[model samples]
Target: MSGPRMTVVFATRDRATLLPRVLDRFAELQSPPGGWSLVVVDNGSRDRTVEVLRSYTDRLPLTALSCPQPGKNRALNAALQHLQGDLAVFTDDDVLPEPDWLVRLRAAADSHPEADLFGGTVLPDWPQPKPDWLCERAVEFSVLYAQQRRPSGACGFADIFGPNMAVRSAIFAAGTRFAEHVGPDDTNPLYAMGSETELLRRLEGAGHRGWFEASACVRHIIRPEQMEERWILNRAFRYGVGEGRHYAGRRSVGLLVRRLVYGIAARGSALLPPSPRRLRIRYRDRWLAGVAAGRPAARASPPSG
Candidate 1:
């Protein structure tokens, strides 16, 4: 039997400086027997991202498209129509796949014909001289960076993280799409965080199974600015927002009280030594606060294709 034909999809915005390195890694990917193509959607980048993508046309089987919309999901939804192949692999622009990434995904799809979704390990590509705090909390904070390392086998949609995930193209062909209202929007700071999770869960609910391919790994680049305390805490809050939206019906008076108590305790813990416990509590508190906020009000509609 022939290997699965694949279409790798990712959206980007204002990451001109990072695109070249990412595309360089893509150029290094070992193509599967059925071959593969890339569809990169530029989501309203004002920087030199367009020019950078143009320069890579000769190096990779790349189809660069534009959404001009601010949200990551909006851009992704637009690219769905352009996909080619039996598998639709989704990842972020900042992620660097191992040379055998696509080959492994194709193999997994071939091996598990029953599964419709696939996820791989995502390790951090930390900056040199990594901060002590990050070192201590890397595993605890992995979700903030969309990183995961799970055993290869049957898995749930929650285990299939963004940054490194693939789904059968038939799903998209049937009109399933990333939620436009939730996910990263360049114009909105308080946007909900689970752009991919929402889609994965919806698919799973529809009876689609997922598989984790341990050998197919990718490295998510840890940017310098993300190392700061403020950024980390803010990310924690956003994560909670996503969780809150995911479990919107679970809120209650008891939960509200617990959140208030935790919020106060987290604030008091700040004066003590910066241990992982303190940071964890603080992160939990921020997440609780976000849960209280629930989903943000609906934003402007994404631009039509």
Candidate 2:
């Protein structure tokens, strides 16, 4: 594809003060060799987020849309409705990218015609005196946007993260649609998983490929509340359920062993010595592996003769 006309679309609920910092980062992006644009979606905030967003009308073409129904995908689909680009990059307001973030995305899009979706690393803004729990189990949530190169078989899931990922605008011609099958809310009538995770699966199911680019980067702000162990586990559990909804049907036997090991390990990490930063990596992987196995297999162990 010709170097696509691109736009960055961000979604958020609150964090009025925090959102501006990220917006500032987006505003700072330089022109790509082909050019790109930006937009934001407000997912229902009672705070001063709207007032703050209004200040941007003078600096860039930033339109703020209010979406109260919730779900990141809904906000995303709403934002998607406003853009006229060939590529629409979806990120969260909490992530601050380098000055060249958009520029790099355009470059990647320009270079790879086969790449329908793309993502990059999210370096953490670790707090001073980073809490042990954060360095331990907390990094899991913090590093949701962390960078990695995915194996070819699973590039879609490996490169997926709602806070720092992008897709071609052509895919959203229908509106800000979420899979009635998956996304962030188990309680949601439309929830089967998360937007990014489900979207990647759809792209692959539809025969498109998404990949990670080492140079496309973003830095995510780690909120203090996210530093809590309980909060981290809550996020992990939700991630587990989300992963379960997707990868759990095939690969049943392999998933069974891993889920049991992780369930015990997650419980053990909570009781025995505090979890380590390294274990944080295992948290998502374990859940995704077990989840890739699904509810039934996740509930059972591999049978031995």
Q: What residue runs in model 2 are displaced by over 4 Å at the alpha carbon?
A: 1-4, 131-157, 174-176, 180-193, 248-305
Question: What are the lDDT scores of the predictions, listed in order?
Answer: 0.84, 0.64
lDDT of 1 by residue, 1-305 (tens): 46658999999999999999999999999988899999999999999999999999999999999999689999999999998889999999999999999999999999999999999999988776655556445326566677788799999998988899999999989889889978999777766788888999999999999999999999999898887666777777777677778887664567678888987888798778766677777777776777766644522221111
How does model 1 score by TM-score? 0.93
Model 1 residue runs over 4 Å out of place are 135-139, 295-305
Q: Among these predicted structures, which one has the highest TM-score? A: 1
lDDT of 2 by residue, 129-216 (tens): 5655445234544334343433322256556666667787777785436664445432443223455767677777888787676677
Task: Evaluate model 1: give its lDDT.
Answer: 0.84
Distance from true position, residue 187, model 1, in Å?
1.8
Candidate 1, residue 149: CA error in Å?
0.8
